[model samples]
Each structure stands twice: as C-alpha cells, then as structure tokens.
Target: MSAPTLAPYVFKRPWLRNLLNPLANWYANAAGYRKLGLRADDLISEENAVVAQALKRLPMKENYDRVFRLRRAMQCSITHKLLPKSEWTKPEEDVPYLGPLIAEIEAEAKERAQLDTLTVVKNH
Candidate 1:
C-alpha cells in the first residue's frame, strides 16, 4: 500500500495551498518532463501489476497516445533534444489520466482482500 500523503492536509488549508501552489508548479516545470511532451502521470513507473491492470483499462485512444508519448520521449532523450515549444505539453494538458484508474484498482483490490478475510456471525 502507498504511504499516506500530506498533500490533502496541506491542500485543505487555503493559506497553505496558496503558498504551495506556485512552488509545486515551479517544481513540476523544473523537472523538465513536460518539455518532452510527457505528462506528469506518464512519468509513473509501469512495471507494477496494479499499474499494468490500470493501463489495460485505458481507452484505446489514450492507450495509443500514452505509447506514442513514451516512444517520442525516449527518442528525444536518446537524441538529447527537447520537443519544439508548440509540441511541449502545456500545464493545462498535463493532467493525471492513469492515476485515478490505478487508485480505483488498488481500492478494489483492498476491498476484495477485506471481503475474503471477512468473518460472518451467525444469529439463530
């Protein structure tokens, strides 16, 4: 299971969120993946079974786009070149497409485990 995140706690406070939002954006931009046309979610490692299942559930078009993005990013990396500005992923376009599905899958798995281990009490 993933460790708990402080993000929601910080996000709940308007003052903290306002203070952190710019820093978060700056960090994301400075990370440089968007310059290669990859979204932040695209940076997630795909080798895990949960992620694999989540990937399989993606719409065909998004699945195709994801593969294309990864290949293009790899090629750019090998060539030591970034995509042209127009091709770079814009902030608004860099949304999490796979994260929700992965989280859903993990939640379902957790629920299934809970059900499997459930004990029923008999009332006669």
Candidate 2:
C-alpha cells in the first residue's frame, strides 16, 4: 500500500492550498497521462483486489470507454506518439468513477475485520 498523503491537511490550509494548486495542476499535466487520453485513475494498476472489484462494478459504458482509452494509450505508446491536442483527455473529463467504490469496499472489509475480532458479551 502507498503511504498516506497529507494532501487534505495541506489543502485545508488556504494559503498552502493556494500556493500548491498551480503546482499540482502543472505536475498533473506534466505527468502526461492526459496527453495519452487517460485519466489519472487510469494509471492505477489493476492488480489489486479492490481495484479489480471496482473495475468489475463499473457501468458497461464506462468499462468500454476505459478499455478503449487503455488500448488507445497502448497503441500510442507503441507508435511513440501522443494523441493530437484535440483528442487529449480534457481536465474536466478526468473525474474518478471507481475510487468511491473501492473506498467503500475497503471500509466494509475493515468493518468486517472489527466485527470478527470483537468479543461478544452476554449479560446475565
């Protein structure tokens, strides 16, 4: 698992967030997944159980689109060419669709573990 980020803590401080906002945007764009027509989440490895389950839960249309984008990115990689600027993934279009589901799954797993380890008490 990746180390927990302090991004929310930084973001909660207005001045820090203001200072970092542009830098974050610049870094995101510079990362170049957008140029390949993929969202940031698309770069996430699918080998994780949670992510794999989230992928299965995606709506058919979103799943198809995800596959299409992945294939397009793969093809671009093979050709060593980026998609045209017009075809690049737009910033507005890069929303997370599966993250919430994965979080929910993880929370459920944690809750299940807590329940499993709980000591039951019977009052006389």
Candidate 3:
C-alpha cells in the first residue's frame, strides 16, 4: 500500500500520529547522507544542513514528541558542544563544553518552543 498523503487532519488520527511521531526528525535527517570530513568547516556545513532540513520538515509531521525532541536536540546542541564521548555518559553531572554556536541554537529552540506552545493552544 502507498504511504498516506500527509495533511493537517491526519494529525487528528491517533494511530497515524503515533506511528509518525518518533520518526519525524529522524526520517528527515536520514535523507542525504555524506561522508564526514577531516576539516571542521566541512563537518559543520554538512551537519548544519542536515539539521536544517530536519527542522524544516518538523512542522509538517503528525507528532508532538517529534517537535519536542527536535527542540531538545537544538537546546542540547546549544548548551553542549562536542565533548569527549566519555562526557556523554556523565552529561547530567558534568558541565558542558560550550561552543560558539550555542547562542544561535538556544535562540532558535526558544522560538520553536513558543511556536509549539501556540500550536497546542490553537488545537485546544
């Protein structure tokens, strides 16, 4: 069978919303893969573009948690930079190694959160 054509009303269908929720950002980001680069600029460009596409597609999905996860991902990326893998194990207890991009992500996350809140209010 074909995948259902997406529409705003699709979100009102509980089963459809449940199935699509967790996979929304993941599916978007998984599109267009490329090899990682040794240079920092190349990596940043690739990663940011993937994230931008995922974020752009977020609003079209049928799930709230997908939006929440994306918001949290943006917040975490802003608050925490590329620390060693060991740091991920103790993230809650450890201080994040902040990077220059933190402010931008934080601002974007804040804006998205406000928009989400408004969406929820409208749906009520």
Q: State which candidate has the highest lDDT.
A: 1
lDDT of 1 by residue, 1-124 (tens): 4547898899789999999889988998899999999998898888889988999999999999999999999999999999999999988998899988988999999999999999999999
In candidate 2, where is summed lDDT lowest over 10 consecutive residues?
1-10
Top-scoring candidate (TM-score):
1
Using all chains and alpha carbons, the TM-scores for the candidates as numbered come to 0.93, 0.90, 0.21
- Model 3, position 58, has a per-residue lDDT of 40
Cα-based RMSD of the predictions, in order?
Answer: 1.2, 1.5, 16.2
In model 3, the number of clashes is: 0
lDDT of each: 0.92, 0.89, 0.41
Error (Å) of candidate 1 at residue 62 is: 0.9
Write candidate 3's Cα lDDT for 1-124 as tens digits: 1124574676889898888766853543343111110111112332454345434444354225334434444555677644344322221232222222343555677889898888433554
Q: Least accurate stretch of 10 residues (summed lDDT) in model 3?
A: 32-41
- Could you tell me the TM-score of candidate 3? 0.21
Q: Indicate the worst ten consecutive residues by lDDT in candidate 1.
A: 1-10
Query: What's the residue-level lDDT of 57 in candidate 3?
Result: 44
Model 2 stretches astray by more than 4 angstroms: none
Candidate 1's TM-score reads 0.93
**Which has the better TM-score: candidate 2, or candidate 3?**
2
Better of 1 and 2 by TM-score: 1
